[model samples]
Target chain A: MSMPEGRMDEQTIAMRVAREFQDGMIVNLGGGIPSLACNFVAEGREVFFHTENGALGYGGTASLEEADWDLFNASFQPVTPLPGMSFFSHDEAFAMIRGGHIDISVLGAFEVSEKGDLANWAIGNMKDYNGDVVAWIKTGRFPPAIGGAMDLAAGAKRIIVAMTHTTRDGSPKVVKKCKYEITARKCVSLIVTDMAVIEVTSEGLVLKEVAPGLTPDDIQAVTEPKLIVADDLKEVEL
Target chain B: MNKVVASAREALADIFDGAVILCGGFGCVGGMPSTLLRALSELQVKNLTLVGNAPALGLEAQKTAARTMQVPESYADGSLLLKNGQVRKLIASVPAMAIYRLQEPFPIVKALQEGQDIEIELVPQGTLAERIRAARAGIPAFYTGTGTGTLLEKDKEVRQIDGRPYLLEYALKADFALIWAYQADRYGNLIYKGTSRTFNATMAGAAAVTVAEVGGVVEPGELDPEIIVTPGMYVDRVVVRQGETG
Candidate 1:
């Protein structure tokens, strides 16, 4: 099988995920690629961004000259505040997440199971090592930082995972079951990856859109489980 | 009725060995009581158990972004305590050494690598905040579905609530709470600037002694009652930062 060509880059993947945003939606964008989605929200559509660190209705990343260490996003990047922006305590911020107030949460993942389980926090045998720091470091594995991913996964009304289809070594990231530490169980609703746009449904993983020039078979080759191709499956639109 | 202290060192003067201190902040120095942490370091108090969001990126790691960001030269965090071998354990959500300068050598990681007896308990960010808030609100325990199926659920009590599984978490309390705020009244009413509020607001009154490091202090009635994020009653002491007017 020939390797698929013209895979979407991080910016393109974020752009595709941004299309899922609706006006006036309160969205929480996790670090890494998910953070880029804020830059691609359609013009005229108003989306309020929430950070777990305690700020809502913030604008995009601030320029160096305008940077304020106190004003930052969940990614720890300085951001500009918008009119009507409000700050709250960490408890209040997480209350918005756990109380079913956030409209959408877009997050990056290490592994996403076919059943929509998320495993983005830890890797390798770090979970079972039992705090043997010397041995753990010798294995070159740093302790995983859970952050707010689990709370966002379990509480956000809808979860959209944005990641590459495969790891750098061509290993599948969309798998039958997550081998890494699970962040949350069966929480993902939509997945926008570099290779395809997939949806987690009651039936199974549905292939909704493939990157341009890639076929359903091409996507399936890199995925772990069999995919249910959508009837209206089409090329990913930027 | 005045709660104002002259300096950070005086604010934390009562901290002793083996005390459990809650340091409030998210990831950056903006939300942290940097001056207090520095004082704690200078005091050389040992065996402290720290509770917060991250383990705190030390001054060296922060220096990388100091050039482009709004970081202050006097910035410090719990890392100062860790570097001084003062912390015995840390309970936090994100325990990573340095988020930006990943390659930098962190004292906590170095101590761990050398097999120093430092313990770290990882909690989800929301759960951590809720736990601290619960302590302040006088709630002993609560059920939440945040860490039901993860490693964090190990040895925890789990119950089915509304057909969903939840882990029972006890309220986390501390001996002292070190926090940062934008302004304070002589009576200790606090108002924070921007996102710097983070854990600071939630941690007030959550500990035996809640100390606030503020940019400035105003007359008791000078601050409008409506805008105060933390009531004066929750704060035990308020310390003005150096070179700032009261």
Candidate 2:
């Protein structure tokens, strides 16, 4: 398999995820790639942005000069509340999620299995680690955050995972089965990566679309599990 | 009868050493009782157990470690309290993200790393909220499937509900709850502004005494009943915004 000349950027992944959102839908954006989707929401589309921090109908990031410390998104970064936005308590916020009021939730993942099992929480137990000590000390054992991702995964009507195709060491993230602790089993519906767009189905992982300038073989070489190619495979549209 | 206090210092006067406090906030922003935290820092009480979202943004630790970045104003809720070494234990969800690790670890994580006296018990965000809500609602314990196969489920009772596993969580009641609101009346009824209502509303009545710091305080009849999110019965005292008239 040859290396592809073109790879989708973070903005492109966000744009692709943004395309899945529809008008008037209550969309929850997790940190990282999902959070970037806020900037790409289609103009004139009435997608209500819900922050797990107990707010709905909020706008995008605020300018530094205009930053109101009280107005922020779930990422703990400052945000601007749009007109007619409402606030609730954390209890009520999760109630809205568990009650199925949230139409869709976009989250970042570390590993997604063929069965759509998510293992983004803590990478396998750190006690078994035999890696560099200083690097381990700097990186720490557990991922620094897992705020409300599990609740969102269990509750959202639909879950879209956004992540890079591989780790920094070029290891595959899409695997036969997640070796880490599973956050939710068989919960992911769609995945938008920097390399390709894939769908998690009951049958197995299906190749939906490849990034521009990349061939199916390039993606297949990195993907640990066998990917079933869609009959109408095409380039991912932004 | 005016239940209004003059300042956050007076509002938190009864807080003793080792007292458990339920704080209300989302991140460094949104619904934090900023004044109360400042007062708590000045009071210098030790061994306090704080329950909240991100009590502090943990930015100062980063600034000290990096020496390159400027530390922003610690306007968030419990930054002062932690900076002053007040917290003994913290029951919170994820306090900070991966970005905070770039320079210095978040205060809580740093404390845990250094083997300090501080302890942290991580809770799922929803379960934490529901536990507090259950206390306010007079519910002793409830079952949820949130932490079922995770490390959080250790020692927690797991029951099968409709063949699905659900972990049992008990109510979380504190000695005092410090929260912020957009507006409050002399009767202590509160109305919160956009995004600032995060954990403030749920924690209102979950403690033995609930103190509210509001942007403004009005007469009883001034606030619309329909818009009041927390009733006066739940709030023990209300303090108008410090250094400003409402």
Candidate 3:
């Protein structure tokens, strides 16, 4: 199949996702592409960045010269403290999340179903038997780690999945059904991918925006489920 | 009364085999009680059940230092216990193996692959924290919507709260808690620096014996009672790390 030209990059995808942020919203950015959205929030908008590790309202990551070992984000990178930043225990931090205080949670997913199901934590690796590849096993080879993703997905007021449209091997990430382990069922509200921006609605997966030169048909070529083009679908804007 | 102990080894002398330990930290050096973990590793206590956010903790510190070029004084974490074969089970949110570095399995994963008697229970990070908090607060169980319709709800009691499914999670109490703090008074009132307070403050009163590894110990009145994160009532013992001023 011929692919569309001018796909968005990780930064562009993050920039597109950041547009969803609003003033006074308490946002939690998960690992990978979701974490980049913290840097792209619109200027003059007051957003509180909550890291599940402990601190809330932290600013951008700290430089090596200004690094403080005790202060870091959920990704384990040293972060700079903001004026209103406050530190709490893990229980309090998770309470803020699981108590439905967080306005939005942008998470990175390996697979996001058309029904809004999320599967991002673990992937089974292939095992060979007698010089032939056998089954994709999860037990001994790849034990899945279910971190705060479930809590955030299930507890946050809104869940937005930020990821590339396709896997590294050119497989569709936005699928009819998630084959891997599910993080949460029908929790994702918005999906911002490198190829297209889709919203999980009551009707179906609604195609909201596509990459600069790509069309809805081009996005459907890669997506596993059929796309419902929005009434005002437009090219993805930064 | 002075709760200060001379060393980590002395503070953890009562830790026996088959003990349940709540180790504090978010997989980084600042929050981890490295001095106590190092002493625990050297003590060679076996069959420990560790509860924490990250099971393979020190590796994150090493990775962080490598990336930022700011090496901590010590990198001891739960891996030391796993390496010594002292941990029989790990109850944590993150796996023993680094999710990023799946090619290199940690000792816990290796033992599991070898069919050894090791168990891993992956709990969502929030549930784990709330369970520990529930234990400390004397709550037996609580209902939460954090793990509904997921693998975490398997065999767990589920009830509908406000038309939403909520899972009943039990308190996760422990035999001992090893926590790190920036400063503490002789009365055991603790204060942590920055994000180092993550699990350290949570696990303080959740265990039978809460041992704090602090950088410095001061007089009771030295610490402002209003600013102390953990009151002395929760902390049973306090040990100042070596090379740190008390």
Candidate 4:
């Protein structure tokens, strides 16, 4: 039998994170939810979305033909480049990111620890592979080759991961420590999930806010690891 | 070492009671130099002229010694001092954009609208970079094709270049420049890897004293010259970092 979709789905979580963006943000939206973020950025936020192919100030995807074939998000998905945008070599592109021009990096993740360790790119046995997992996906040529995730994970003012609270098999993606390879050591600042909004802290993973129709218990039960509930935990609006 | 100190308190020592500083960076990238900025609290330096992009850390910084001149951007923590009438003047580019992030952008705008001396000077991004470069290069001023024939012409000195009127912009230099670097040789040569080069390189040559806090400190001759963006001649005294990562 086909499964039914829930009311507050993953897309809702994506929008919630997008709204957090403020004016003058030079944000790098990763391949997944990050790319979707353009639709939700508020009308006046004035965020300049950057892609690997040297396009900046891009937003809101339009007709497929109108999209720049060469200018795409991290995933190489055809996207519309915004105005006041410029183009440059892909390697030079990473220089801008490495130069600390980016404000926030909103990404997708497979696992996260209480301290916000990330493991998005590599989860398989590293002893065996050469660390070209992005190439293994075979979508398109990644000229820059995901060159800056490590830098982004380390240098960006904030690193926010957006993912479903649980895995398809009902397993909690949030754990005491991630099972996959660590992308960054204790780098996560925020995690937006379908059921809740969590902020990583020194003490432990704290449940700052819960999602709609999800009681504290409902989220708590599904979350394998015990979460520290802030004294003022409230329902997450965005 | 000149009995060197690290923490923000110790770093501000040489910052005079009154000085003009042109910071480097876009937002946190090159905006404010760390060691100098950190030391600023200790210097408690008062009444200053400054320029450049701002760090994401709002507009004002801890103003213990004294307050900054003009409230460049509203979010600047330093503006608190300016608003209290502690400062004499405040200036910034895109004062409207600066005040936009605040609780009330227009009160400042209204002050400018209702006549509050309107000390703001709106400058184009590329022109700002060019002027800073010319200032560092020791040129008095240069003309650019950017603001020559339009509304920007009124703000700038319209000069004839090749029989055409071009906007004349003066070179902008600073008494001190605070910067961040990936690593520094004891000789004062700076190597900025990744996004660290933004405005820091331009300000390095433009300032009288450039103080840098690097993530790593190394002996001379270790770093590749090709990677060195700023030579040691431009940097005055070098201050290595005390346990900084990323």
Q: Interface RMSD, all models, one decimal each?
A: 2.8, 4.9, 3.9, 20.9
Better of 1 and 3 by DockQ: 1
The top-ranked prediction according to DockQ is 1
Reference-based TM-score, model 1: 0.95
Least accurate 10 contiguous residues by lDDT in model 1 chain A: A131-140
DockQ of 1: 0.58
lDDT of 3 by residue, A1-238 (tens): 2234668878888889999999999999998888888888898898999999888898876888877778888877777888998999999999999889999999999899999999887663112322111111114454566788999999999999999999889899999998877788999999999898999997999999988878788899899999999999998877
Clashes per prediction?
Answer: 0, 0, 0, 27
Off by over 4 Å in 2: A1-4, A81-84, A123-143, B61-76, B243-246
DockQ value for model 4: 0.02
Chain A TM-score for each candidate, in the given order? 0.94, 0.91, 0.91, 0.85
Candidates ranked by lDDT: 1, 3, 2, 4
Tell me what TM-score chain A of model 2 achieves: 0.91
Best candidate, TM-score: 1
Question: How does each model score on TM-score?
Answer: 0.95, 0.89, 0.93, 0.46
Q: Where does the lowest 10-residue lDDT sum fall in candidate 3 chain B?
A: B95-104
What lDDT tens digits, residue by residue, belong to model 2 across residues A1-238? 2334567778888999999999999999988788989888888898999988788998887776655646778776667778888877789999998778999999999899999888775555433544222233334544334578778877789999999999888899999988766677778999999889999998888999998888889999889999999999999888
* Tens-digit lDDT track of model 3 for B1-246: 999989889999999999999998887666878888888999968999999988454565356444755455566778878777788878888754334453345556655555556666778899999999999999999999887866666689999978989999999979999999999998899999898899999999999999999988988889988899999999999998753211
lDDT of 2 by residue, B71-124 (tens): 345454575676677888778776555445445566665654665566666677
What CAPRI-style quality would you assign to candidate 2? acceptable
Q: Native contacts retained by model 3, as a fraction?
A: 0.64
Docking class of 4: incorrect
- Cα distance off (Å), candidate 3, residue A83: 0.9
